[model samples]
Target: MGRTRAVALVGMDAHVVEVEAHLAASVPGFTLVGLPDASLAEARDRVRAAMTSSGLGWPQRRITVNLSPAGLPKAGPGFDLAIAVATLAGAGVCDPESVAAQVHLGELGLDGRLRPVRGVLPAVVAAVQAGRHRVVVPAGNVDEARLVPGAQVAGAVSLAQVAAAHGAQVEVPAVDPVDPPRSPEDTPGGCDLTDVVGQATGRWALEVTAAGGHHLALIGPPGSGKTMLASRLPGLLPDLDDAAAVEVTAVHSIAGTLDPGTGLMRRPPFEAPHHTASAASVVGGGAGIPRPGAISRAHRGVLFLDEAPEFAPAVLQTLRQPLESGELRLHRAAGTARYPARVQLVLAANPCPCGNAVGKALDCTCTALARRRYLSRLSGPLLDRVDLQLDVLPATRAERRAGARESSAVVAHRVALARDRARARFQGTGWSTNSEAPGAWLRAHPPAGSAVRDLERALDRGLLTMRGADRVLRVAWTLADLAGAGRPEQDHVAQALALRSRTAGPT
Candidate 1:
């Protein structure tokens, strides 16, 4: 008998799976039991070729390898190394006890080399949390695996090296370590706020969005600085705390977007998918099990949808669930996977299909009906979930030439201060921003009677849904924080109502 440990990733969550092997004096065949996806099931040939290349002869007897917790669906080639090590132990080529205590994670190449696999960071975290701190990963993943505190990590370059480390008398070959891929911010042009020349309303909305972790929508024609404002929103946000850093890093690891060499991701992430992206790619879907989508990758960060109207309606509608709950629940045929999706969604769109419908509509080409249908692509329910909706008007030449409008650094300072106020206000609530606070909690701690009057009237007039009313209150609280007020006053509520009711194009 031989046994070792590996991690099976289900969305953002990871589980430690025990890999056990049994040898019998019967037909010389290899049998892999337990539920493994197609990629994992193909590990048989990979392991065989790797062992043969390493001079580790295959067992002549019937070899049976079972991934315990047989019901847990395992996928990917990450389990190949664990399977190979366990098989060698059962074949008596390596001491079983030597490998059983360590968690093995890597893909076995046909040439006996160990290849780096995604999700090593989360796997190591799970291994350490499970009280099994010893982890053996590929050289390329060593930096990421070591990020987990109290984890004993070893980087092996080849199968022979791992086998030799586990008491097998084998000569390990020297090979170059695999390098991790870089994850550039995808920030085209630049990521500075000053690049946005004008649109005072747009900049103010961005500040409020960042300060409270709220969703925003910017409507206008082309070259209106919508994308520029949206991209700079992440800059105004503060760095991720320790807990959030680990969580955000884990999501990127699972999504294969994190660069392990950079260590933990401290800055907030930014994900902007194209409009033509399918619902599965945007909302998190796959064949057997679903993986993290753009929203999940943007966890603890921002998800910008440029050209929002062009996106599939199905894809846009799917965001309503995560927006309401801050969690992505992807149900597939095999199992259901959950990922954190507490993101600030930023949307930018043209007022008309012709890209010329602003101001007096002098240059506009689309008909009234066409313009109405254009903006209507963004559903009312979806818009209601958004906290800030502002139109980006064409910047005047004077505004463009204005000397040094507030830079990202200046605005980020104010945003940080405002966020600090909100954090102190909700100290023990486990929520960091105004947007995250429960509506019931907000109602429980109402600001003032007069302040509530206008909001109540809006609700009574049917202008605001029950959900929209709560969101308005949240925005009012954020406004109060920005103004250094003790609580939202009538003026703050009025401003919030105005910000919420503003729209572009027809409606």
Candidate 2:
């Protein structure tokens, strides 16, 4: 009789799974059971090959492997190293007690070498949280695994090394802390507000949006620099705080978007999915278990929906909840899972399908009705949540030939200063930006006088819904802050309201 212990991961999360091996008198074979996915079920072959290559003989008698906590669905080949180690320990070939307090995670190759596995960071974090002080991971994942501060992590190059550590002394190599590559903002893309040439209004809108973390939309014709402006946004935003950077990196890791061997992502992410994306891909869904979609992956960052009106109506509608609540819920028959989606949205759309509706250099081919139908895809509910909307015009030929644009660093400095001020003003409130302030807080601390009355008047005229009124005020406050005003003024309110499209009109 032999018993061993391990864990199984579902998604990036983990749970303890004891892999118990029973050597019984029967036909000589090996069997694995307990709700294992295809990847986990195939671990037997890889484990066997690893053991054979490492000079350990396969247990010839009838064998049964049981993964405990049978209710949870286990997936991934990450269990290979654990399975191999447990099998060897169960067969009495190695001492289990030697690695008793450690959580082991790694895939095994046929030649006995340890291979990198996905979600190593999350697994290590889970192990630390579970009070497991030690974690044995593959060498390639050593840096990623060490992101978990409290966990004592070890790196093994091969299953043979891990096995050797169980009996005779074997030294696992220490992974040096290699700083992850800095974000594009650190290097500073040469684009700048000044380079935008004209469209001063568009640039101001972007500045305010950055200061307040507000969602924005840019409607313009081609060559108007909408995409160019959108790309420069990341540079205008402040560097992510430590907690935010970790979470951003975690999402990228779960999505397998993290660069190989990268540590933590220090800057906020920028995710721009194509317009043709399915609702499942944009908002996250799968037949088995839902995964983080573009919205979730953009947590603590920006989700730029370029060519916004070109997206499917269903997909565009899916963003309403996440835009409002900073989280998205995927409801499946089996369960409901939520992912963080506190992202600043930047949506760019052509004012008309023809890309030249408002009398640009090109003649308009699209009828007014056709243009209205196209823009109407963004439902009123969706547009109401967007805090700022700006109209962009094509840059003049003179501005284009000026051959100079402001560098990202120049705009980034102002953005950082504004963010610091907001943080300082809202310290201890859990609301760092004007856009994040709750309606209750805004009302209680009504921005010094007639602004509240003006808002009430607008609400009375049915110009704003309850949610819309709140978002409008939030935008007003953001506008005032950008001008260095002490409080939101009537002018700021008017500016915010002007930016909002009427519910009855085409968006």
Give the best candidate by lDDT. Answer: 1
> Considering summed lDDT, which 10 consecutive residues are worst modelled in model 2?
178-187
* Runs of candidate 1 exceeding 4 Å displacement: 181-190, 447-450, 456-466, 503-507
Q: What is candidate 1's lDDT per residue for 1-507, written digit by digit as tens?
A: 889999988876788999999999999999999865877767889999999999898889999999988888786329989999999999888899998989999998999899988888888888999999999999988988999999999999999999998888888888998666566556442478877887777888888889988889888889888888888999999999998999999888877788767889898888899999998888788876687899999899999999999998889889989988889998876678888998999989898898788778899989999998998888664776788887778788887787877889899899999999999999998997999889898898777789888888888999988888888889888988998998999987877777766642221
Q: Per-prediction TM-score, please?
A: 0.95, 0.87
Cα error of candidate 2 at position 381, Å: 4.8
User: RMSD in angstroms, candidate 1?
Assistant: 2.5
The superposed Cα distance between candidate 2 and the true structure at residue 489, in angstroms, equals 1.8
Which candidate ranks first by TM-score, i.e. highest? 1
Residue-by-residue lDDT tens digits, candidate 2, 139-217: 7778887887897888888877888877724333333322322222222245566656766567767777888898888
In model 1, residue pairs whose N, Cα or C atoms come closer than 3 Å (at least 3 residues apart or on different chains), thus clashing, are none
